[model samples]
Target: MSELPMTVRVDGLPDRVTIYEVGPRDGLQNEKTVVPVEVKAEFVRRLVAAGLPVVEATSFVHPRWVPQLADAAELMTALGEEGRHLPVLVPNERGLDRALELGLEHVAIFGSATETFATKNLNRTFDEQFAMFEPTVARAREAGMDVRAYVSMCFGDPWEGAVPVDQVVTAGTRLLDLGAGQLSLGDTIGVATAGHVRALVAAFGDAGVGTDRLAMHFHDTYGQALANTFSALQAGITTFDASAGGLGGCPYAKSATGNLATEDLVWMLDGLGIEHGVDLGAVVATSTWMAGHLGRPSPSAVVRALAG
Candidate 1:
């Protein structure tokens, strides 16, 4: 295993940043095409080979919700023997049951910070959503698995407009109290500016949530993902979620677009001389291959600019 840098600079930037590769799960979940099980497994394999330390393998949500990732069982079985840090998404107890049955060691649960988004995306109110997930997260932790909770619409929600930072922090606290070891703050609608990003991170810190237990998940709806990531770095956040080729968006959030592209994030990290243990050229090639499978050009500017 490669040893990643751990030094925290005086300016609050990390010597090394951890990239949580979410293309296989979050990225492909929003795709209209049904990616083959073998293809999804291959995508995971290529991402790990390209040196991403953590890759979200698949989501165990019901097929009725996300048909594209319905083959979660088959895909996990294919990669069951691989020794990699692959986290699967488990929406509730049923989803957690499926993941636990597959013997997954790391998992992520999704939630929304705004009440409107929570009701629309999860079909549950704020309290009900946490009530549903508490047992699932606790059970996973009891089984010796690490759980990550994702609080979406952390900055702005299409239905609610601007989400207060305090509201986001409260949701994050609930998730962490549910036995989730880490919380991922998601800009689901991509309305977060660099200033918003900085303020949110600072607010979380002020609420007693350390940057060490937080990750950033951004969308590019307004072309602000990279800039927001820069702000996150300055706030001492070292982990980020990026999608290869920028494949996913929230179907419920109509204004949302694809995620922060892995290639684009890598370009910025490279320019900053940060140590991320990822091979930029290899990631670009993987995204290009996936674009071919999707029958569309990659939405990533870095991929288009480089592959051209």
Candidate 2:
């Protein structure tokens, strides 16, 4: 058998890429069982040490909504004078209040592009969910928090099927107008293809949204996350979201898998000579550690190959 190609040199690649590591929050949020608070903290610590600039620490959502992150407050407190930007997910005003009480300066708000996914995932219509975020975003800004808005199911929705490109662009622009510092387009069900990614970026650009203010969040469900990422990069998007060890699944979408792994992203970036300032080896080690703790093999190919 031919040896697997580790990386490719795509011409005209971006000089630098910003990795927003979401392992702590997104990766661990969907686990069937609750991970120990200390272990979660350690995972964040190791991620920071790996030279990731932005590490999503935890979510401030109510325990009833997500029991896996019930220890959000404690996890935030325990991150301990971090090495990376620690952002937490705030689902609403209450979650924002909790995040403020924890003295968190960076928080993210999530909304959906498709009404079906929004209703199923957040239990509200698209308009209702967007309305709920207005006050939350205002409050976070008032409290001096940097707010990032996640637009889930941007390319396609499992429930609604192929999402209209205009719908995605409208949602993203609305979030930006509502004071989202950055807009992250999420391929929540991992159904996005490279062509879908390019179309989405073009739509956003047509709406006058700067590519620099956008981030791409892809899941590896159909094994298109990395290829979709390449499409985004070609479209002038430098910021991307990833989870270490490929942790996280869409709690609302049953068929979804974890986000793209940080190890794989770093490996790809390094081979492309992209400047991410992340230690690939350390990221691989961290993924291995977390995977072991979860009693499962890592979903990251780079972690498995490099460890061997």
Candidate 3:
């Protein structure tokens, strides 16, 4: 049997990268079954114990919109101190208020790079979406919270064909200008290629947005996530958004599949000798345990390989 790969250095790649774990929030958001609040909290604990520096806890989005996370308040209450440091998704001022009431300090805002996605997902025009985010971000910043802006559909939109790189840069810059400490570029549909990833990062670089202020979130729908990640590494990106066991996808965009698997990503980084501070065996065990709750096997190839 093939064992875990030996670490090998890759030039131009950062010595260590931050693996932003999104399992609790993005991973469980689209679950058909409402994962128990305790189970979700335990998931966070397990991820933390596995050395994931950042684990997105849950979203404060309205229950009607995302029923899977309806127990956001209860989850936060259950997590208490552990939850405070974790970032939660706040769709608007109301969501932010919920987070604030729970004493959470870090938050994330979701934005769309295309007009159709903005309209379909957020119920606002692409141009009007920023206005909605403005108040929430301002309030969060006023409260001394770090805000992350997620620009979805960065590569291509289901409703709109190819999203212009310039348009994505424009939207990303606008969100950055709105007090977001970092911007996560998302391939919501998982249709991006390595070339597209380079072009977009280069465009952002030209716009004066350094790679440090950027993160990449890709799905495995088209199986290009790993390639895209390598491209981002070549572009000097140090932060990546991944979900444990390849859980979750875009609920608003039906075409999207699971996110880039955290275990799979860690495996690649391990082979590349990139220090991403995660225990792959622990993550695999965690995902295996969680998968039992979800009533299916993990979609992550590394999980299947290692768990087997």
Q: Show where candidate 1 strays beyond 4 Å.
A: 1-12
- Per-model CA lDDT versus the true structure: 0.89, 0.87, 0.95
Cα lDDT of model 2 overall? 0.87
**Considering every candidate listed, which one attains the maximal TM-score?**
3
Least lDDT summed over 10 consecutive residues: which range in candidate 2? 1-10
Per-residue CA lDDT of model 1 for 1-308, tens digit only, reads: 21222333345567899999999998998889889998899999999999999999989888988999899989999997672257999998898888878778898999989889889889999878999898998899898999999999999988789999999999999999888999999999899999989898888889899999999999999999998999899999999999988989986888889999998998788767788998877888999999999999999988888887
Clashing pairs in 3: none
Ranking the candidates on lDDT from highest down gives 3, 1, 2
List residue ranges in candidate 3 displaced over 4 A: none
Model 2 TM-score (2 dp): 0.95
TM-scores of all candidate predictions against the true structure:
0.95, 0.95, 0.99
C-alpha RMSD (angstroms) for model 3: 0.8
Where does the lowest 10-residue lDDT sum fall in candidate 3? 1-10
What is model 1's C-alpha RMSD?
A: 3.8
Q: lDDT of candidate 1 vs native?
A: 0.89
